[model samples]
Structures are given as C-alpha cells and as structure tokens.
Target: MLKITDLHVQLEEEDKKILKGVNLTVETGKVHAIMGPNGSGKSTLSYVLSGREGYEVTQGSAELDGEEILEMDPEERAAAGLFLAFQYPVEIPGVGNMTFLRTAVNAQRKARGQEEMSATDFLKEVRAKAKSLKIDADMLKRPVNVGFSGGEKKRNEILQMAMLEPRMCILDETDSGLDVDAMKLVADGVNALRDEGRSFLVITHYQRLLDHIKPDVVHIMADGRIIKTGGPELALEVENNGYADLLEGTA
Candidate 1:
C-alpha cells in the first residue's frame, strides 16, 4: 500500500542529511518493523512521509497506493490514509478528546467527499472503540493527552488510529516510556486493527514490542540507510548481539 524509493532528506536549515536513499515497500496487510540505533533516521522517515515541516526531500518519492504524497500537505496526507503516531504525543489543553476525534474524523470524511458522521453515530462508534482500547468515559471528556499517564497517552494514539482507520500507519517509538502491561495493551489495540486492507510501519529500538506485534519483515537501519533486511529472527539477533555486530561493514 506504501512505496518509498530513493528518499533523500536533509534539514531545511542545515546541510545535515537524515535519510539517504531509503527504499521500502509495505504491501497491504503486512507489518514492517524498522530497527536501528540512535540517529538512524527511522523517525525522520516517518515524519517525512507524513509531510512534517523543516525537512526537505532532496530526492526520491514516497507514494501511497500509487499516488505521490511528498507534494501533498500534512492534512492531505491524512485524507490519503496516512497516519503517524508521534513518539511523544502532544497535549492540547482546551480541546476535549472526543471533540478532537469527532472533528478529525468528520474533516477527513469531508476531504474524501463523504458525508459527515452524525453526532449519535459518532458517539456510539467512539464509545465502542474507546472501550476496546480501555479508554474510560472520563478520559474522553478530558483534553487530549493532558494529565494522561504514559500508557494512557499511547492508548489514546491507538484510539485515534482506530477512529481514523488509516490504510498506512507509521508508529514512531510508540513503545517508548510504556510499561510491560501498557505495551501489551497498546499492542492489542494495534493488532485489533490489523486486516487485509491495512499496513503498519513500526519504528522501534527494541525487539520486545515485536514480541507482541510480530512484524512480517524486519529491517536494520544505520547511517541514514537500511543496512539489512530479514525476518522476525533479525530482531532477536539484534536483541542478543546488539548493533555492534550488525554495524560491521556498514561503515
């Protein structure tokens, strides 16, 4: 569902390049995990694909379902079925979570030339989805991510994903700062959304998350490029051996 070819990105204000020729293809219904050490540009790839600012794509293309997305705005990318779960989900102090969710959903629908979901239908659907994610009614009434615990924040992100139902999801360190139980809860939410029409690009530093959300393909990235590609065992290999061994000849 998503294809990236020869992607080259650099800081807009400086000459430091983050991603150099990143080529990846995520088929519909597949889960692809990207593992690398610090500063490997995994998160940068996610931001670039989602059309975040301050990073310029000097070369290459990121296409979602055969259409180029690099030229589109961030909101346009969302309407095109691209979602990015931030590493640190930001807090919106005044906006209730429900209000934010409903507005976002309706906006995307409108952008896609579909009718907005009615208030009754939206409330029912959101409540059901929130229940599945273990999000309480009180949490929904609160401002987005404000006063939420680490796990609660992560679960809220999954709730957004569930409501949006994006075709391609990019998770940038969703496991960070999450406890064991929290990680599993978030993973369950993610697994619940997996289907024939959806795909996931999970960028994480540890293999423990993969134990819960088993990826079909695992990639080791270093020096702004994907250095190795393997199956699930590759993650375990990195866990046991560390990137030291993997970095051998990568320089």
Candidate 2:
C-alpha cells in the first residue's frame, strides 16, 4: 500500500540528514512494524511520509498505492488515504472533540467527491466509535485533548483513525505513554480495523505494543536506515537485548 525508495530527508534549516537512503514497502493487508532506538530517524520517517514542514526530501520517492505522494500537500495525503497518529497529540482548546472529528471526516469525504455525511449519521458513528474506545459523552463534548490524560489522547488518535478508515495507517509511537490497560484498548481498536485492503506501518520503540498488535513483518532501523528485516522474532530480539548489538554490527 505504501512504498518508499531511497528516501533521503534532512532538516531544511540544519541540512542534517535524518533518513539516509531509506527503502521500505508496506504491502496491502499486512502490518509492518519498525523498531529502532532513539535518534534512529523513526519518527522523522513518519513525519516525512505525512508531508509535515521543516524537512526537505533531498532525494528518493514515496508512493501510496501507485501514485507518488511526496509532491502532495498534507491534506492531499490525507485524502489519498495516508494517516499519521502523532506521538504527542496537540491540544485544541476551543474546538470540541466531536466537532473536530466530524469536520475532518466530512472534509475527507468532500475531497473524495462523496456527499457530506449528515449530522444524524455522523452522530451515530461518533457515538458508536466513541463507545468502542471507551470515550464518554462528556469527553466528546470537551475541547480536543484539552484536559485529557495521555492515554485518553492516544485513544482519541485511534478513534480518529477508526472514523476515517484510512487505507494506509502510520502510527508513530502510539504506545509511547500508555499503561497496560490503555495500550490494550488502543491495540484492540487497531486490530478490529485490520482488513485485507488496509495496511499499517507501526513505528515504535518497544515490543510491548507488538505483543498486542502482532505485525506481519518486523524491521530494525538504525542510523537513518533499515538494516535488518525479519519476522516477529526480530521484535523479541530487540526486546531481549535492545538496539546495542543491532547498532554495533553484531546482530
């Protein structure tokens, strides 16, 4: 569903390379997990894929399905079925959670030439999805992430992903701050959406998340490049020993 080839990205201001000739291909219907230590450019890869500012793609190409997405704006990428769950979900003090979600969903539908979802249908979906994520009505009425806990914010991100139902999901450290219960809820929500036509690119630092959301492939990234690709055992390897050996050329 997503293919990135020789993607060389660097900060435009600093000119310091973050992703050096990175190549990855996430197949349709498969879950691919990327595990790396700090400074491995893991989050940078997700940011670049999402078309965030401050980073320039010096070379290489990123394609969703068959169309190149590097030239598209962030909104275009979202309309094209690219979703990024941020590591730290920003707080919007003025907008209600429900309002924000409904706006985003309708915007994407409009972009795809589909009719805007009526308020009745949108409310039904919002309620149903919120229930699945254990989000209450009061939470929905509140401003987006305004007073939510870390776990709540992460679940909110998953809720957004579930509502939009993007074809390619890029989860950037969705497991960063969650406790056991919160992580399980987030994982269950994600697993429920697994489909033959949808794919996931889970970028994480730890294997605990992988235990809940098993990946079809595990990749070890280091020094701005993916150096090792293996099955699920690879995540276990990192969990048991960390990225030291992976970085020192032993593993």
Candidate 3:
C-alpha cells in the first residue's frame, strides 16, 4: 500500500511548483489510475515518489507500507519494494540485458539481506518473465532498450517489474507510444502479476489502456492536485468529455 498526504513539490532550480497538495492512497491489491491533461504533474508525482533528483518535496510525505520513503535513497526505496516504470526507458549501451538485470536483482537482494540468486535460478526466472512479456532471446541479448521499439521498451519494463516483484508499482504511462496490440500485450503482462499483495498506480491520459487494465479507482488530476476521485466510470467520463469540463473550478 502507498499513502501520499498533502504532497507539495517544486522544481529545485525554479520558483514553480509542480505538485500542490497531492493526497492519494493506493490500497494493497488494488489498481488506481490517474488521468490528466498536459502539465498536470502526473509524471512529476511518479518521479518524486521514486526519489528522482531536481525536485524538492516542499511539504507532506509519501509512505510505503507505513514506512517513510522520502529519506531513502533511490536504491534503498527499491529495496523497500518501490518500482517506477518510466514512460521513456533509458538505453544503456554496451551492457548485456541479462547482465544488467542480474546485477540489479542481486544488488537489491544484498540490500535486503537476502541471499543472491545463483546464475541458474536467475536465468530460469528471467527467461520465464521475458517470455511472458513476449521478449525474445535476441532482444535480451542486446543492450537494454538499445534498439528496442516502444512496445519492446515498455514490455521490458514490465519484465523488470515481474522479475523484481515489487509490492507497489508506479507505471508512468506504460501505454504511451504503444499501439492497440502492444498495449494489450503489456496490459496482459501487468494483469498476470496482479495479486492480493501487490498494488498498481497507473498514470495515463486516455481510457484505452484502462479498458485493458480495469483499474479499481480513477482520479482526475489538474494543476498539480488530485481534484476528483471516483470509480472506473471516472475514466469513461474523461474519455467522453475530456479534462476541460473537469477543470472548470479546479484551477
């Protein structure tokens, strides 16, 4: 479960505020979707929660399973079961995909005081997860996201999520740049991992992705604040009317 209360964030080098009082809770075993227009701070909230630099938390706090994560380093947060699947997955050239993944998996295990998985176990696990996400062997042999298509990158992100098995997953627009088939494939991978012990916070601009991923709750965010909360129908409303009607007095 993730709990965010009155969270206010501002860019470190400027006077502009990005998240002004973002209070939301993602209960365990549930999927929560946040829909908003451009510059609404949806992505900013994801970065801030994952401990990305350049943004200062001016007020409030974010907690994962009742533990404060604001003070933890990025890797420390990962060790504590927090994962962010970026909208644009970065490319790390000259590093084999398997090598990068094994290092990350073992590093987190070391940080959590768990034994490192042997090469055989990791190989078995990664191959299974990659297959589920439709990641072929050739793709895994290449550098991370080096020549991957948009859908491949997103699927790779899901594969990371599956391999890590984080309790709270923040998917920052996993549907971005994905066509219908790719989106459905990605959603299937996400849905396969849903369980009573894991939760998801999906940030998106449209409802097509929600159609595939059926969120339990939907929130309308505008001007750095979550202004409205409702059920899955809320996403339908946004698709029907857009954010203009919802933004009438939210400014």
RMSD of 3: 0.8
Please provide the root mean square deviation of candidate 2 (C-alpha atoms, Å): 0.9
Residue lDDT tens for model 1, 1-251: 99999999999999999999999999999999999999999999999999989999999999999999999999999999999999999999999999999999999999999999999999999999999999999999999999999999999999999999999999999999999999999999999999989999999999999999999999999989999999999999999999999999576
Sum up the clashes in candidate 3.
0
Candidate 3 lDDT by residue in tens digits, 1-251: 89999999999999899999999999999999999998999999999999999999999999999999998899999999999999999999999888989998999999999999999999999999999888999998999999999999999999999989999999999999999999999999999999999999999999999999999999999999999999999999999998899898565
Clashing pairs in 1: none
lDDT of 3 at 204: 98
Question: Least lDDT summed over 10 consecutive residues: which range in candidate 3?
Answer: 242-251
TM-score of 2: 0.99
Q: Write the per-residue lDDT of candidate 2 for residues 196-236, one digit (tens) a residue.
A: 99999999999999999999999999989999999999999
For candidate 1, the lDDT comes to 0.96
Q: Pick by lDDT: which candidate is best?
A: 1
Candidate 3: deviation at residue 13, Å? 0.9
> Pairs clashing in candidate 2?
none
